[model samples]
Target: MFNTIEHINKENRNWLKSFYFIHKLSFRTLWARKASWVGTFIFSCCLLILFPFGLGTEALQRADIQIGTFWIMNEFVAVLTISRIFSAEQECNGMDLILTSKLQKTSIIAGKISFTAFQIFTLQIPILLLWIIFYNINSNILVNLLNNLFFVSIFFNLGSASLGTLITCLTARSLAKEILLPMLFFPLQSGILLASVSLTIHIGNNSLLGAFSESAWWTILIAYPIIFSTLGILLSDLLLQE
Candidate 1:
């Protein structure tokens, strides 16, 4: 019993260390390619700007249109960013190195998902601000819905990032990853995407309490991240095996 407990503790420590190593590597890669990330940020902003022209300025006044535009732009920028999770590693066979190392596969997946989720969350900040500015969000509405939006965005990022990272890993070796990714990702994303959009619309129209009153949307928002994260963890060993 003591030996088993010791083994478990040692494994936990190793997992923690591996998770930290991957996160640090991800940060360094992000820093090294700062220009690319900046360009993605700029491109997302441009996409946000362009939406108004196509939808007409008046469309922004409608909550569904406003939320829809934000989510659509979000999906696009997120796909662009998430697609790069393994690009840097693959270029120099870094993933190959990691996969063969002593590090735990589950920890590696966790680290990647955490970083990707954080990165996407960070990127969403400016777009969300611009969204508010571009649409001239009413201060009262913003204040009333601020907490709800914050939680909704967190759930949104977590679900999408977990699923996106997993899908990216699954397609990492494919010759047609770019084409395959969006085809697989976007369709799978429809549930969380629709849930988030609906939650946003509800919160915007009905506040957090009111949104929670709609049990179905609330359930999807909560279940999405949990489901995808569990799937990613459970499959990491199989996915990363040689």
Candidate 2:
């Protein structure tokens, strides 16, 4: 149970505490279901491998190919990763238990989002290693790659987590919630996928673009997550009203 939020408590403090508690609980719950998490992780790895093929070797080798093949791979994995977060909970009736807890609604939602983000981060490691090996990138380029990957992961996670939270909240009671959840995330995933691919290509060609740079494309990546995370938090209150 969370420390009670008195009426006079500052909103920022309350939300911050709630976010922390929620993330903690979510991680614990997710750890309890290790098999499913591992399975999803492996599946993401396989999908990442298959994605480079879609871009073709020629494109992969092209230095100027905006949003190179690896970006495509990460984007694909992002979709699958985000969709699984809430849908898996729905299947196990975990959302109901979470909602019934004394924790703030925002906390519950943030916790789930955090867990999904961590899972996605874990899934990206092998893909990153593969890219490092295949691209024969120098040490400086490798550092840049890591920076880009970090931000891209954050961007995709925010959007995907927002979409997942929205779906889970809206369809918590529906028999078809599991299926419906993934559908809600598809469009968001597609956008992130495109952005990721474009960013990947840009970074591969130009080593100077930091992940959080002021460039228009970087702005898009940064903005999408901020917008979605805010929307998700706002929508969560209404969605959990029942």
Q: What is the lDDT, from 0 to 100, of the residue 87 in candidate 1?
A: 83
- Model 2: per-residue lDDT, tens digit, 1-242? 14545544666677778778766655665667776567766765665556467666655555544235556555556666665665555567766776676657776667677777777677677767866676555564567767876877777766666666666677666888768766766665565566666665565665434354436666676677677667777777786763
Model 1, 6-76: lDDT tens digits are 99999999999999999888887775879647878898888888988998988778776777788888887
lDDT agreement with native, every candidate: 0.82, 0.64
Candidates in order, TM-scores: namely 0.92, 0.74
Model 2: lDDT equals 0.64
